[model samples]
Target: MFLNRKVELSLLENLHAEGKPKLILLYGKRRVGKTELLNEFARRHRALYLVARQEAYEGQLKKMSSEIAEFFDDDVLRHSPFQNYDALFIYLAQKETPVLFDEFPYLVEANRDLPSILQEYWDRYFSKKKTFLVLCGSSIAMMESLLGYKSPLYGRRTEQILLEPLKFREACEFFPQLEQEDKVLAYAVLGGTPAYLLEFDYGKPLLENIRDRILQKNTFLYQDTMFVLQQELTEPRVYYSIINSIAKGNTRLGEIMNDTGLEKSKITKYLSVLKDLHIIERRVPVTEKSPESSKKGIYLLKDNYFKFWFRFVFENAEYIEQGRQEKLIGDKISPVLNNFAGFAYEEIVLEYLKSSPGFPDYIFGRWWDKEEEIDVVGLDSSQNRIIFGEVKWKALTEKEARQTLNQLVEKSVEVKWGENLKSGEIQEGPEKKYMLVGKKVGGKKRLLGDGYLVLELDDLVEN
Candidate 1:
C-alpha cells in the first residue's frame, strides 16, 4: 500500500535529523494519502499523533484536554489551570515530542482565531520549547491561506509539504500481475489517488472492479465526486454544472458558460475554484510564451476519476437510477471510454518520460495549429535538446509505426524553437533528438538514426 512515498519519508527523516522540533504544514486534496503518510511517519519516529476533531471550540478543547491528559499521564487537566490556548501550549511546550494537528482546517473552522492563538504560543513558547508541531489538512484553500504571508501562522511553519498523487508507474507497483496496458487503463480511470487504487481487487478483473466498486449503486466512490464538491462549496449546483459541462467536452470558456447556463464572469470564479481543487485544468498551445496571458486557451477536467464520473455517472443519473445502468454505459460511456483510453495512453507516455533516464529540464506538451499533435515533448533547455514523442493506442505493425513516426517528425517542425535559437546554433546543443512512444513500435532503431529512440509499453516499463 505504501508504494511511492520514499521521497516523502526521506523528507520527514531529514527534518527529524535536524534535531529541531520543526513546525510543518502538510496539505493536499482528500484521499491523496496525507493522513496515511502522516501516520506512517509518526509510527516510524514514535511521534505523538493527535487528530483534531472538527467540532465546536469547547468540544475540541475537551477532547484535546483528554488526549493531553492521557499523553502526559496527568490528572490535573480535568481541573487544569490552562485558561486559553496559550496556557494549553505552555503545558505542551514542556515536552520534546511531535504534535500533529490532523485536519487542522477543521479545528480552524471550529475556532477561526486558532491560527492567531497558535502563532502567539509558537513565537512565545513552542519555538523555544523545540516541540515539533505538524498541521495537516485536506482543504487546499485553508492550507494555502494558513501559510500565506497575510495569515497569523504565516512565518511560523518551518516546512510545508504539498503531497500530490502517486505517479502512473508508482501505482503499477500495486498490481504486479497486471499488464502495462491494463495499468495504464487503471491509471486513466482511478488516477494516482492512493485510496482509489487500493480499493481495486487485484484478484478480480479490472473492468469488473470498475463496474462493481466504482459504478455500483451506493458504492463509496460512486458519488465521491459530488461529496467532495458539496463539502467544499456552498453553491454546489453551479460548480457541478460547470464541472459537468467541462466533463462533457465544452472546453472553450464561452462554451462552458453557455452549457452551464452561468454568466461568463461568474464562470471565471467557478473555474478558479475547480482549478484550485486540481479537478479541472486550463491549457493553451505550447508555442505560447505566456500561457496565462493568452486568451485562446481551453479548459478540461484534469482528474481522471472525476472526468469519468461526471461524463458517465452524473450526466446519465436518470438512466442509471431507472435500472438501465448497463445499457446506458454501453450506449454512451463505452464510446467515450474508448476515446478516453487513447488519450490516457498518451499521458502514460509523458508520465514514463518524467521519471526516465536523461531526465529533461522542461517537458512541453505539443499541440499544433491543426488536429495534428504530438503526445509528449521532452526539452532539455540546459542542453538545447528536444525529444519529440508519438503515442498511439491501436495495434501497430512495423509499417504502421513507421508512418506514425514520420508524422511525429513532421509535427515536431511546427514548434519554432528553431527560430528562437541562433541562426546556426541550437539552444544548448547542435542537434535535437526524437523519441517515439506508442502502443506499437517496431524497427525504429533501424529506420531512424541513433538520435531516435522508439519506445513501446514494455520499453517504457523497462526504462
Candidate 2:
C-alpha cells in the first residue's frame, strides 16, 4: 500500500550513509505516513523504532527501554530498565544505529523535560558519536517548537521534513481498479491521505463505498473530520464553524464572518491555526503583487477529505444519523458532487500542467476580479509569457471547446498583465497562451492545430 515518497526515502537513505551522528526531525499531520516511512527506513538499516503513546512518563520510558534493549539484544538492559532517557540515549549513542521515536510529542506531553533531556544527551554524548536520531510526530506545532530559538532542541536537528499528503495523481494510483472518473470522485472524498485511500473498496460503486464506509455511523471516517479537529484544536466548535462556512461556499473573509458571526480578528487567528494544521489555506489571485498583504484573500479547505466531510457529511449529519443514507446521497450529494469535483479537478489540472516538461518555470495560480475569474494562470517570468486556462470537469464537444477557449482568451485580455508590462513594471510585453483542460475535449486536435493547448483528463492522469 506504500506509494510515492521516493524523494523522502532517498533523503533518509542519504542520511544513513553519512556515517556521522545526525538528528532528523520529521513531522506532519496525522495519517500522512510518517510512521510508515520511518518503519520502512528502519527495515533497511540497523535501527530501533519506538512509537510513543499517551501513557505516564515512567510507562513510556519503560516501554522504550524494553524495545531498545531488545533491539540491541542486551539481556541485562532488558531486565533493568533505564531510570531516565539520558542514560538510555547515551547507551544508544554508543551504537552506530538510528533511534526513531515516533509520535514523539506524546513523550513530550507526558514529560515536559524530555526535549531538554534529549538536548543535553545529544550535546554531551550523541553529537560526538555516529548515532542517528529521528524524532517524528503528528503535532505540527509541537515539532516546529523544537526548532524555535527558545526551545531546548534548537539547532540540534541536522535535517527536518514536514511531510505532506500525496498529490492527486499519486492518490489516483490507490484505486487502479476504478475508472478514471471514479478515481477522481473517490479522491474528491478521500483526499490524498494513504490511510483514507486504503479504506475505500475500489471494486464497489463509488457511492456504495461512500455510503457503507463513510456515511454510516459506525464507520471509521464517519466522525473523522470532527475527530481530527478535536485532536488538533482546543475549541473545535469555532474551528468547525469556520470550516463549515468555507465548505458551504463562504470563501471570502466577509462572507465567512457574516456566516459564522465571529469577529474579524478571531477569524484571522483561527484561520492562522487552521493554516498551520494544513486543514485550510488562504489564497490570493495569482497576479497579486504582495499575496500576504492582499485584501482579496479567500479561504479554502485545502484538504479534500475535510472539504468533503464538511460539505457533505457534516451538512447531512441529521439525515445520516436518521439512517437516511440513500436519501442523503441522491438528494444532497449526487447532484452537487460533480460541481465539487470540478473545483478539485481544476486544481489537479493545474498540478499536472506544472509538472509537464513543456511547461516553463512559472508562478502558477488562479486569477480573480469582482466580475471575472480565471481557473488556471501561469506566469513564466523567464520567457515573459502568460498562460490562461479554463478547466471543466465534464466532457466538451469541439464547439463547446472553442467557445470555452474564446472566453478564456477574452478573460486573458481583462487580466492586468498587459498594463503591468506597458508600465515598465515587467520588462517584456507578455505573449499570451490559452489552454483548455477538461474530462474530454472532442476537438482537442483541432484546438491544438489552432494554437490552443488542450489537455484532457486522460492526458493529465496518464502524465
Candidate 3:
C-alpha cells in the first residue's frame, strides 16, 4: 500500500545520517498517510514510535511509558510506569535512539505544557545525544502552530515535512489493472489521500466500488470527510454549508453567500480557515498580478474527494440510505462523472508540468478573462513564453483537437503576459505554446507533426 514516498524516506535517512539530535515536525491532514510514512521509516531504522490517543494526561503517560519500557526492556519502569511526561522524556533522552510521536497533538492536548517540556528536555538532554526526536500529527492547524513564534517548540525543529496526498502517477500505482480513464475517475472519487485510495476496490466495477465504499452508511470512506472536518474545525456544520455551496457550483463569493445565506464577512473567515486546513482553495486568473487582492478570485473545494462527496454522495444521501445506488448512479453520478473527472485530469496535467517541467514555465494555473478560459496555463515571463492548454476528459479526434487548439489560440490573444518586454524593435506578442490533453487523443502524432503539443492519458501514464 505504500506506493511512492522514496523522496520522503530519503530525506529522513539523510537526517539520520547527519548523526545529530534532530527534532523533526511531520504533519498533514488526517488519512494523508503521516503515520504510515513514520511506520515505514521506523521499521527500517528501529526508531521508537508511539501513537498518542485522546485520554487523560496520566493515562497518556501510562500507555506511552509501557511502550517505552517494553522497548527498552526495563522491568521496573514496565511495572511502575513513568510518573509524568517529564520523567518519561528524561529517561528516553538518556538514549540516542530516535523517538517519534505520531499524533503529537494528542499529547499536547492532554498536557498543554508538553511542548515546553519537550523544549526543555530537547535542549537539556537530547541535544547532546543523536536522538532524532520526530513529532508528527494529523491536525494541520495545531501541527503548524508548533513552529509558530508563540509556541515553545518554535526554532527547535531541525527538519519539518508537510506530508501531502499522493500525486497522479503515485496514485496510479494503486490501480494497475484499470484503464487510464477508470484510473482518473477513481482518483477523482478517492483523491490522492492514501487512506481513501486504499478503500476503493478497483477490481470491482468502478460504480460498484463507489457504491460500496462511499455511499454505504458507516463505511470508513463514507464517514472520513466528516471526520476530517470535525477534527479540524470547532464549527464543522458552518464550514459544511460553505463547502457545500462551493461544491454546488457557487464559485463566486457572492454566489456562495446567496446559496448558503451566510454573511460575506463570516464566509470569508471560514474560507480562510478551510484554506489553511487545505480542504478548500481560492483561485484567481493565472494572469493576475496580485492574486490575493484580485476581485475575480473564486472559491473551490480543492480536495478532490471533498468536491466529489459534497456534490454527489452528500446531496444524494437519502437515496444512498435507501440503497438505490444503482439508480443514483444512472440518474446522478454517471452522467456528470466525465465532467467531474475533467477537473482532476486538469490538475494532473498541471502537476505533471510542474514536476517535469518541459520548459522554463514557472507560474502555472488555470486562466480566465471575461468569457475566455483556459484549463491550464503556464507562464515563463523571463523567456516571454506563455503556454495555454485545454484538457478534456473524453477522447478527441484530430479534427476535434485541432478545433479545440484553434479556439485556445484565439483565446490566448486576450491573456497578456510580457507587457514590459514590449519595445519598438521587438514588436511581437509573447511566444505562445498551445497544448491539448485528453483521455485518448486521436492522431496525436499528426498533431505533433503540425507543431502542436498533444498529450494522451496513456502518454502521461508512461511518465
> Best TM-score goes to which candidate?
2
Off by over 4 Å in 2: 418-428
Candidate 2: worst-modelled 10 consecutive residues by lDDT:
418-427
* Ranking of all predicted structures according to TM-score, beginning with the best and ending with the worst: 2, 3, 1
CA-lDDT, candidates in order:
0.77, 0.86, 0.85
Candidate 2: what lDDT?
A: 0.86
Model 1 TM-score on a 0 to 1 scale: 0.92
- Candidate 3 residue pairs in backbone clash: none
- lDDT at position 56, candidate 1: 81
How well is each residue in 1-463 modelled by candidate 3, as lDDT tens digits? 5667878988999999999879999998888888878899889989999999999999989999889888889999988888887888878877878888999999899899999988998889887788898999998899999989999988988888999888888888888888878888888888888888888777899888887888888899888889888888999899888898899888988999999999989988999999998888789987788788989899888789999999998888889888898888999999988888888888888888787756545688888866677898888878777778999888898889999999887777666555533212246766667899988888999888988888888878777
Model 2 lDDT tens row, 118-167? 98888988898877889999988889889899999888899999898888
Q: Could you tally the backbone clashes for each prediction? A: 1, 0, 0
Please give the TM-score that candidate 2 achieves against the real structure. Answer: 0.96
Worst 10 residues of 3 by lDDT: 417-426
The order of the candidates by lDDT, greatest first, is 2, 3, 1
TM-score of each: 0.92, 0.96, 0.96
lDDT of 1 by residue, 252-283 (tens): 89888788788878999889988887777888
The true-versus-predicted C-alpha distance at residue 43 of model 3, in Å, is 0.7
